[model samples]
Target: MTTTVRWHSIPELVRDAAERFGDAEAVVDGDTRLTFAELADQVRRTAGAFASAGVGPGDRVALWAPNSAEWMVAAFGLLTAGGVLVPVNTRFRDEEAHDIVVRSGAKALLVQNGFLDREFTGPPGVPVIDLKSDGRHGFLGSGDPLERKVGEDDLADIIFTSGTTGRPKGVMTTHGQTLRLYEEWCDLAQLRAGDRYLIVNPFFHIFGYKAGLVASLIRGATVLPLAVFDVDRVLELVEKERVTVLPGPPTLYHSLLEAGGGRDLSSLRVAVTGSADIPVELVRRITTELPFRHLMTGYGLTEAGTVTASRPGDPYEAVATTVGRPCEGFELRVADDGEVLVRGYGVMRGYLDDPAATAAAIDPDGWLHTGDLGELDAEGRLRIVGRKKDMFIVGGFNAYPAEIEGFLMRHPAVAQAAVIGVPDARLGQVGKAFVVPRAEVSEAELIAWAKERMAGFKVPCHVEFRTELPLNATGKVMKDRLS
Candidate 1:
């Protein structure tokens, strides 16, 4: 398997790809298109630009932007120059972005200032390079690439977690880990050469950067980066570009499935989705309704990259019920308390610059204590029950929102559902379901529906109907805002 081939560092991989897939279509964004060789040239020039701007090896640089062809170039260039990448979420406000830039000790900032109608001025005193400006390519150097020795083990990026809890902590990873893991991910997802991949996931996130762009690079797939998810735009792109590989959260597929009926999506053969809970019905619809030959779901986090995934030929039930067997050499086990533990090469080095928190998360035995509660079937497949912190007690009975939410989704009226524990006088805490209904449905009707389907303690005591639920950039429901 080519998965065994090691490039040592991302720069090496960039150079190797240029040689191996030189004339193949690499990246396409609207009017802009580049071959693999051209993409490599841009990466080298960008690296030289960074070197000229006083970014040295090991220096941290903040990348704040949406998904674009330029975003991929800038990221590859940053890695080529041996600068550690710090990708800020595009949804972050000025204050939120400023906090990450300052905390990560980013020496420079590459940003698209006018994106989403917000001006990202970047932090004071830091050099800000506007990636969207006409002068952006002027930063590219005319000379040969900068001579920098970036080792595989060197820190490649510091990706911050979604700050649903108190504050986001930086998850540090290396180029070696990134390259190795995603190779396996591509093999499992059936991503291959000549495939056009529509990357709608944000590049700042691991899935987009590693599983989207990096995997495309490895397999010689064409990259079509979509800045935002619009169902019509996505369908248009899939038909026009003949996009073959599309992986995203469940919401992206739901939107596509609803509107993609008359479109020419026969070119789309590979589809992978997983970030939040997925309904079995949706999985069934995707298989029966869509033209995809390969469809799967997997589980992972920023702390652990591509730990487990469903391989091609796996049943739809495995894709829906379990995250599949472990990939990328990860060893998985459930603790006595039900928390899932992962030990692998893909685990993050540690929380960047926070030893106390690192020590608390990873045990002395080299096992990462994933705070998610899960169970293993006899076949060794993992079914994520819920997050340990997200679980709530109801009248001394443990109730998982994911489990209840799954039950609620079985109802025909519920388009989307998110359950949160709300304060209750008698039960200490009870499930409060926030639902986005497909048809006319009352809160009392949903509560009654839940009552008949689940245990009395598991049933939601209250239900709130809404047109839509609050979603993060990745289409994950923001449970933090539910109350």
Candidate 2:
């Protein structure tokens, strides 16, 4: 039986949350905590300031700050003022940032003065408002509300995906799309008003924005923000705030395991990880070492919101091996070429006016051709093998690099591994492996380890040992740059 889903705009969701949980602690960072009422007030004030600055509906306002309360306020403020928010990756270089701003045509930007020794210069011709100045808060202060009108179909944010090949394109998300995403996530994760969430992922990415910010706000949960990922500090926050929910990438889990060092993690009731595959070994380690029994791994793209997620009550294997079923209001299918196709409200509204890209990505029937390659099991769970563009043909055989990398990660000595296709005269294109070892392990050792488990062609033609692999802002290995 099918059921009709009710949709609300982003501002309406925020209004509902504030009205329902007005006095509840909505956000916490360091020593600062803002109640739901106060959070709404800040959003309105920031919106007023933006309106005064002449930002209105449909104008793109970019935010290039780390995980801070101001970032959240700026995002919501832009939405409240009917402005479109464009989130820039904090790890982007000046050139990358400049390219995004110019391509997106952002009228203004909001950024921190500096983060992690990196100072930001505002994009050319675009006014930049700093969030912090001389240790005093900047922007988001109390002000009068701005009279604005927005609908569910209005644009909310333009999140740029990590461009593995070339320049990043902005993925437009509508207010309705974001609201449906938050509600779907809340229902799938069984979120409750009593939950306290700790967010380590950057707010720029959809994973953190929807899962970390919108999910918590809509559910009347508290959000504890961290500007950076400090393994020790994260553990301390979990203990101090009694943080109930934890969300981040797989690297965070690995770091937490190393930093945990027998620290008490009983307060952590749920841990959600995404942005890359969660190694089964890491899943096992978390359950064995950490006090949290509910560990989950999910899948999402900037364009598709979060389509697939594993639930806490599912089997450990499901959470470890598969990306779970598609979230509610979404349909998933495997194309003839093995690409994952999605159709849902959560799918983005074309690539922000790039007709060529929009036509290439979404079909006429509204099916978004997710570049990731995967297959559905008999139980309807989706197992992501690798990116379609990353797949290479070896001697007329298909080789998925992610599968090979996953095999390499199984070795106890390997810290991280990236598999890429290097041009080979014999096979046209063959797989090559680059590894970062936990200890001193030679290429010969890794080659032998992989050969034993995988077919000869699937084995790395050559293994290169490196101190580290080149990772994008979100920490995913940049396979395209390796070769």
Candidate 1's clash total is: 0
**Positional deviation of residue 52's Cα in model 1 after best superposition, in angstroms:** 0.7
lDDT of 2 by residue, 1-483 (tens): 333325456766667778899999999887778889888877888788888788878898888889887788878888888898889999888888888888888998777875978888776688878887611245565446753678878888888878777668889888877877777687677677978888888888887788889999878889988888778899899888998888777777777876777677777877777544556777777777777757666788988888888875888877777889888878999999999999987888878668899899999988999888898888898888988888998999999987888788889898778888888898998888888888888888888988899998899988888887776656677776687
Clashes of each: 0, 0
Steric clash pairs (candidate 2):
none
Runs of candidate 1 exceeding 4 Å displacement: 1-3, 134-136, 140-144
Q: Looking at model 1, which ten-residue stretch has the lowest summed lDDT?
A: 134-143
Error of 2 at 311 (Å): 3.3
Off by over 4 Å in 2: 1-7, 134-138
Residue 135 lDDT, candidate 1, scale 0-100: 28
RMSD of each: 1.6, 2.1
Candidate 1 C-alpha lDDT tens digits along 1-483: 225657888888888889999999999999989999998988888888888888889999999999988888888888889899999999999899999999999998888877889888788998887887832366643335764778879999999999987699999999989999988888899898999999998999999999999999999999999998899999999999999999998888878866887889999898888744777777777788899888878999999988888878777688878888888578999999999999988899999889999999999998999899999998898888888988999999999988888898888888788898988999999999898887788888888888888999999998988878898997888888889
